[model samples]
Target: ARPRVGYFYTGKTGSQLLTEKIKKLQVYQYQSMPVVVDESVSVYDAICTMFLEDVGTLFVVDKNSSLVGVLSRKDLLRASLGNSNLEAIPVNIIMTRMPNITFCHKDDLIIDVAEKIIEKQIDAVPVVKHTEHGYEVIGRLTKTNMTKVLVDIAKDEII
Candidate 1:
């Protein structure tokens, strides 16, 4: 009898291994803490929050803390242009409202969220939990996170 060894050939390429690792990544693994703003907050306030938080997207929540909309840098920019009363304009008026916002779950595949971001031409998406009333924002998945995943995979850091 020959000595037994653990080594075996799977006939898979390096790129295939990378692809499999990426495919197995979940949103929660790379999601960041969500930056949220109340729907009633003024556009001015939302803009400030966006800048202060250093985030491109802000999840808009209602009184019950349920996600109701999304605010992006573009939205604030458009609202600021030729608008003297930014404070008077509520974010809800300028936000992408419910039934239109693209979101993901913590357990969802990161690759799926990346596809949504690309297809929608959006910078990020909220990772949420379904509630009786609506969705509750838990985290955020952004292009930066996706980039990190790629970098990690290239470095063979992801097991």
Candidate 2:
């Protein structure tokens, strides 16, 4: 659960083991790292369906790659209606600010992560960690996948 701990996603573990493995089926697994918008991207792009394919939240990182904020769909709509040049307005103006964004490390267990997401009422959690240069995103966990994990666990308990 702590930051910087390394882990494999369930089947990705490629070994006969359960401990220390985070389930891939229990979290978001994208074909590639989705194109992330920094603090300066256009709102037009924000509304683009292409940008939303695998992203549940628009992560706003600073120039240094540290997560600075997040922009949810509602936030984007509110800004779009208020600004004529939605495409040109800086994202920093509308993004959910720091100190409120909750992130998880990739190594965290799925059950522990599930509780955090449910308690926080977050649809998605950003997976992040520190580097010599700065913190960077590595993955994402979504409510959809968490639901699957919950079902699987329930089935196991019954049987």
Candidate 3:
């Protein structure tokens, strides 16, 4: 057999190649470190952590460090309103609890996650790993990460 050398055109267009690359992109490829808070954390404290961490979403964990809920900036904001003492309110009281929180796994396609984010009108989703007890928060996938991927693809940096 002749040695296959040099570049050979398979007749795929640049857009097709780009689409394929995007499809192959997984949650782990662009996920960021998750900012987590204990479910018992005060709303005031959770708000402070969110600001300090500069994250739009915060994962709420139980005593076992298993994901229990999710706290978004909106949730904190809502809790802050009509309440003079945010410190007295635990995040779990206002957090989107289990069975309601949207999450993705590391192996999930970024495109699917993006669609979920869009369809749910959320800014971010927690990247989790399922354990015997429950889901463990491992990373965070946000709109910002998706934007970065788009920019990188445009620059051909992902190729």
What is candidate 3's lDDT per residue for 107-148, written digit by digit as tens? 999999999999999999999998988999999999999999
Q: How far does residue 148 in candidate 3 sit from its true spot (Å)?
A: 0.3
List model 2 lDDT by residue over 1-159, tens digit each.
Answer: 322225535443333333334343333332124245777777777667435465667777878887877777778878888889876777888888778887777656666677888898877777777877655777777777666655655565311
Better of 1 and 2 by TM-score: 1
Task: Please give the lDDT score for candidate 1.
Answer: 0.91
lDDT tens string, model 1, 43-120? 999999998999999999999899999998998999999699999999999999989999999999999999999999
For candidate 2, report its TM-score: 0.67
Which residue pairs does candidate 1 place in steric collision? none
Ten contiguous residues minimizing lDDT sum, candidate 2: 25-34
Off by over 4 Å in 3: 1-11
